[model samples]
Target: MKYISYYHNPRVSNLLRIVSESPGLTFTEIMRRSGLANGVLSHYLGNMEKRAMIRSKKGRKMTWYFLPHDPIEEDSIIISLRKETSKNILTFLLTKKLATFVEVTRAAKKSPPVVSITLSQLQDLGLIKVTNGFVKKYEVANPDTIMRLSEKIDSTMFEKIKDRFEDTFSYF
Candidate 1:
C-alpha cells in the first residue's frame, strides 16, 4: 500500500513523540499517552501502519505498536517533515541546491503567498537558509548531504528496474 501522509496528523505526531520516548509500546499504552479515544488512535495507527512507520504484533490478547524503523534516522525525519509540509518545496530545495522565494514559487508552480509560507515554515525548521535583499539567496543547509542521501535512498527502486531492463535487453 502507498504510504499515507501522516506528517500533520496530531495523533500521528503524538504517537511518534510517545514512541520516541519509549520504543516498544502497546496500543493501549499509546492511547493512554496520546489521551485519544480508541477510535481516534485506531485511525492513526492504521494510517501509520500503511505508511510502514509503525508495526503491530497481534498477541493472543493484545496488540503492540511501535516504529518498525528508527524515528531519529535522517530519512525518517525527512519523510515526516515532508508529510507535514510541502513536499514540492523539499524537492525544489534538494534539486536546486538553493532557491530564492521567487524561484521556488516558479518552480513549484504555486502562488507567491503559498511559496512564501512554505519557505518560511522550512526556515523555521532550520531546513533552509533565507536572506533578505534585492537578490536574496536561499541556500539549502547541508545541500550535499541531503542531496546525496535523497539520491541514495530514492534510487534503489530505479536502480533495480535498470538492472532488470539491462539483463533482459543487453543481448539485443
Candidate 2:
C-alpha cells in the first residue's frame, strides 16, 4: 500500500512509472527505458525488488520485471502485445465480442495459418475462449482484464518498437 504513494526521488518514480506502464520487461529493457547507468539501475532494481516494491521473474536468458501485484499470467499477455498480429487480433476480438475463424482471419489481416496459430496461442494464454459449433468462434475470455492489460502496457512503447523496425524511415 505504501508503494502506491509517490516517491520523493524522481529516479525511483521514473523507474516505477516505466515498469508499471510496461510490465514483463527485462532488466536491460528497464535500464534502456530509464536512461540510468548500469550500476545505479542494478542497485535500484535490486533494492526495490528486495523491498517488495517490484517483482521479477527469471526467464531462461533474462529477468523480467513487473509491478509487485501483477499476476504471472500478465507476463505472457504483455509479451504477446509486443507482436503486432497478436495485439491486433486481441483488440479486434475485444471489440467484436465473438467472431468465427473466417471473420477473425479477415479482421486480423493475416494468413489463415498464421491467424490459426495466433488464436491458438491466445486461447492457451486464457485471454480468449473458443466456442465449438457449426463454426468455431473466438472471443476474449475476460474483456475487462484483457483491456486493462492492453492499457497497462503502453502503446507508445509499441510505437517505439515500430520505429526501431522502420529504422529512421518514420522520421520523414
Candidate 3:
C-alpha cells in the first residue's frame, strides 16, 4: 500500500477530488465535469497515476479513472465493465437477472453482433456466464458485487448510460 502525498496545485487537487468522489468515471466525464482542458487534465492524471495517487481501468472505448486506493475491491469484472457497452450490458443483465441472447439483444438495442461480442467479453472477464441448461441463459456471476460496485460510481452518469440502452428496448 503506497501513501501518496496531497497535490500542491489546486487543479491537480480538484482532479483527484473528482476521481475520489466518482470512482468510475471515464476520461470524458472528468473533462466535462472538471472543465479542464485535455492536455492539462491528462498531465495531472498522469502525474497522479505515477505517484500511485490515482489509477485507471482501461476499457475498449475509454478508460475509467479511479483512485488507486479505494474501499471497493477493484475486481477485474468491475474494471472491464467500466466500458460503456459492457456496463450497459451488465446493467441490463443485473436488472433482468437471467436473460437469453435474443432477449438481451432486444433489450440492449445493440446489433446482434455487438451484443454477442459484449456477452462473450463479459464471460471472459468472469462477470457473467452462460448457463449450460436448456434455455442457455446469461446471468451475472455475483450480483452482490455488481450492486456494491455500482454504488461507487456516479448515478447520474450510470443512469444516462442506462437510459440510452433502455431507449433501445423501448424502440421494440
Candidate 4:
C-alpha cells in the first residue's frame, strides 16, 4: 500500500504550480500571484515545506521559494538573480561585460554596501567573478547561459514579477 500525501489540496496544488513555474519567488510575490491571504499562504507554505515539496532561501529582505530539484536546474542563475539589486548588477555587467565597483554601483543605482554584498554573493555562487587590483572589477561568468535561461522561464509570470519588482525597487 502506498502512503498518500495530504499536500494535494487545491490551494497547495496552486501554490506548488506557481513556485514550480517561477522558482525563487518571495513569499509576498507568491501571495500576490497565488492570491492566497497572508496567513493562509503561510500555513500552506509551511506544510508544503515540511512535506519536502518546497524549499526556501532567506533573501536580504524576503524568503524566496522554490521546488526541490527544479526541472530547470541549469537556470538556477535566474533564481538567484531574482533580487532587485542582484538583477540590476548582473544586467549591468551583462551589458558592460566588465565594470568597476563604482561603475556597477552607479549603473545599477545601488548603494556601495548593497553592491558590495550582492557582488560577493554572486561571486560565491559562481555566477559572476570579481577581480581586485588597482581597481575592483566584476563580470558575469556565463552571459549566454543566463540569457538563455532568462528567456526560457514563463514570460507571463516573469513579466508580472518584473513589473512589480521594478515598482517595488523604484522607491528604494
Candidate 3: lDDT of 40?
Answer: 81
Global local distance difference test of model 2: 0.81
lDDT of 1 by residue, 57-167 (tens): 565666665567643345332442323245566656665566777778887788898778877766776667877688886766665545544444344533443464466
Q: lDDT: which is higher, 1 or 2?
A: 2
- CA lDDT of every candidate: 0.63, 0.81, 0.77, 0.77
Per-residue lDDT of candidate 2, residues 1-172 (tens digit): 3455436567888999898877888888888989998999999898888888898878577788889888876788877775688988887776667899999999889999999999989999888999999988999888777667666777664454445436544556
TM-score for candidate 4: 0.72
- Clash counts per candidate, in order, are 0, 0, 0, 0
Clashes of 4: 0
Look at candidate 1 and give me any clashing residue pairs: none
Model 1 misplaced stretches (Cα beyond 4 Å): 1-69, 73-77, 80-85, 148-172
For candidate 1, what is the TM-score? Answer: 0.45
After superposition, candidate 3 runs with Cα above 4 Å error: 1-6, 59-61, 71-75, 156-172
Q: Which stretches of candidate 4 lie over 4 Å from their true place?
A: 1-8, 59-61, 71-79, 132-134, 152-172
Task: List model 3 lDDT by residue over 1-172, tens digit each.
Answer: 2335447677778888898876877788899999999998898788888888888877577787777777445646556556667777788787677899889988778899998898888888778989978778999888777766776664564565457557767978
Model 2 C-alpha RMSD to native: 8.5
Residue runs of model 2 more than 4 Å from their true location after superposition: 1-10, 37-43, 59-63, 155-172
